[model samples]
Target: MTTLNHYHYKRLQEFCSSVFVKAGVEKEQADIVAASLVQADLRGVDSHGVVRTAIYLKRVEQKMINPKAKIRIEKEDESTALIDGCNHFGAVVGDKALKLAMKKAKANGVGMVGVKNSNHFGTGAFYALRGLKEDLVTIVMSNASQTMPPTGGIKPFIGTNPLAVGIPCGECEPFLLDMATSVVARGKIIVAAQKGEAIPHGWAIDKNGKSTTNAEEALKGSVLPLGGPKGYGISMFIDIFSGVLTGAGFGKYVNNMYENWKAPQNVGHFFITIDVNKFMDIKTFKHRMDLYIRDIKTEPKAEDVEEIFIPGEMESRRSEQRKKNGINLSQNVQRELTNIGMKYGVSLKDALMLNHNTEGKGV
Candidate 1:
């Protein structure tokens, strides 16, 4: 594994941004995509990080992702909006939607927004965190191409369908829950494949519905829903909210980002924001949240347990540490990044060299 300091990571992000710009995306929009991807890596969610650059570039080359997309509000009211992404990068569209939702929530106490024709939006938590600075509770969800099957079925009919929620606390860090309804995200399998590692059983089934351990095989198969029927139900509802409600592609109509290079993904996302001041004073809400988190953390632990963690606590800690100490990237990821950099006429080695003078060290 290679460790890269925050400075190096930033350089890498700039390189990615340059690639997007070369592919015809506006500089500002390219920066947004790069930042979103790097933020995932900073938070230790490598599955949604810079590893996706290759595929995204391919999509742009194929004209599947509209680099010059003009995202616009199709319909709107005081507290709600429908945005058409026009097939732009998901990060750009998601950021616009979240800001709109936060603006409405601040004015009306609550806000809801739906997005259509977007691409993959790094991580749901990224958008959910938009409302945190405003002392608002935020919920974000997105529907992907079919990768998981409903309970008692073998064929893939629903996507991983991730959901995230962020709630601010007074003394503790905000409570954030970001997860896929599937047992594991498809990106996890892709990562395993990149590392030439075997996947765990029960995470997915082969094309014939048999459990598989080979990551490559799992990629061609179907991921299992988390907790069986419960996860399936949650995923279905997410599809309805993010896809059906937004008039975006739903179920089989959604195109796979990796498979269908010629067509837009038509992915949909849903966002909701609630201002805490609407229900009670912001101070009171924060205090209650702190108390709730304290109780949960101080509860007795099971045997062999060292400590308890609130949602988003571990990721936040990792982000802070990575910013100071540096981030570790696997050799495979580094090599892939180098290739991408070369394609864009940038020297990854030079970029890393420039970071050696920074505060942190890279290995």
Candidate 2:
């Protein structure tokens, strides 16, 4: 069991905020990114969350990502637009893009936005929820660096691209689904390697294209897509739309997290926001969605199955618990946080206490 030191977690957030601000991110924007990353840890999406902070700071220092990149609408139509990310951090650009999409959707019946020259965004669900607040169904996808291999080939050729969807249901929480195309995200492999742990089979193959449980070997190899070839096709489709079509980096042309330093990644993303009222009545859609979820969950399971899970249901519940109880992180994460705090000369434990008291909330 990995135990995260609470003091270290709080300190990490402070350190993340300070670095972001030093990089010229506005205070509010820095806070948002920091919160989003921390939220990922709280929700059990360790890969996307705070774990990437050190890497992000490194990119910022290298000037590969603009600390103060300006965001601009390069093109606009009634319900469509294109955003130039100006090489900014993805969390900032994605939020800006989603805001524009929501605004356009409110004005029109639907909205679609494409962005280019962005950095890596944390989680897709963050943007998806933005659309849901407006009673809109949302879709988001992004292309990433090559980490997964093409079907039948050994070397990496495609990224573990992700697709996310969110549907509003009135008073009920939105039905949200966000996932990586790979059987497991690259971060999991990295984490496993860091911990000297063995990954499961079918999750990765070594450089020789043989399945292996060794995380170190998996790092040298490539991950396989879920459902075999079909998943690879889906990931490729995402690359085409979010990368090639947007004129962003694709395949090996993209920046490798392990190597690239100076050049902007020129990443791309797609977002679609559809007003529920534009289709069937919003209530009708909500009730139908509720029924679908309820029925699927209520159905009988095999003897070994303990329970069924809807994609976001467990996540939402876990988030609630963490929000109230504070998030627990692993020892490695705590060590990283401690390092970050020491670098900044700030005590993480002190910061947590300050934050807790400032919010007038008890733990």
Candidate 3:
């Protein structure tokens, strides 16, 4: 795989912003969208990173997504609100919802927000982490397009349906966990297809509901839930909160990723934020959390287990290295990005550099 230097990645962010501006997104909103993508890459969520630029551009060209959306709060209560995203970019809607939730939390000690008419937002964790600085525990969930099937059914009926949570820690990085409720995210399948590689069995079923290892076959088929019915159940709940509560499209009503170019995906997202200080002394809670984490780390390990790590630890470590050494994107992604850059008159070298650089900081 080829790699982009740090400065180049920063340039990518700049490019994204510039293009978004050209497409009619406000400067501030463009920056937020770019930041969301870069943050995903920083946190090791490669699927949501720079590779998505091409998809966004195509969506704009097809008019499936609004290049310049006007978001507004449709309704509001003391501790909850509903946002009409006006078919904006998911990052824009998500950031707006998070800000609204935090504001309500400040006023009521806890807050929740539901958003609709959005597109793909990056990793759900990016939005959840916004609560950490405010001494709040945050949860973010999104109901994506149908890509996964029910536990025993053959046809697709649910999206990857991700759930993410962020908690303030005592001294370590905040406890952030973002994961797809499915066995694997559709992004992985896309990556595999790009590489012309086979996926592992159990990841997905063929069009006839039979298990398959070929990425292409799986794409025609349906992905599996993480733990059979248990994962399916959780996905359903996520769907209810993100889609049902928000009154967005659900189940088969959701738009197919590639097929629908002019219709809003009608994607929905939910944000739950709770101020930790409202119930207990913030310091005391931190101290107790620290003790709990310490005990968890000290627990006995089985053979072949060199270390026991919490959810966010590995991501933090990978981020440090990638920030310095630059990320090694898969060969297929590199090629695709290069091709897209060519269309926009951005040189391959410039695109690579943009992929490598940090967003706000100049390399």
In lDDT terms, which candidate is top? 1
Answer with 1 or 3, whichever has the higher TM-score. Answer: 1
Candidate order by lDDT, highest to lowest? 1, 3, 2
Q: Which residue pairs collide, candidate 1?
A: none
The weakest ten consecutive residues by lDDT in model 1 span 1-10
Alpha carbon deviation, residue 276, candidate 3 (Å): 0.3
- Residue 217, candidate 3: how far off, in angstroms? 0.3
Whole-model lDDT per candidate: 0.88, 0.80, 0.81
Off by over 4 Å in 2: 1-4, 7-15, 351-363
Task: State TM-scores per candidate.
Answer: 0.96, 0.92, 0.93
Task: Quote the lDDT for 159 in model 1.
Answer: 95
lDDT (10s digit) by residue, model 1, range 317-336? 88877665655667887788
Please give the lDDT score for candidate 1.
0.88
Q: Which portions of model 3 miss their true places by more than 4 Å?
A: 1-8, 351-363
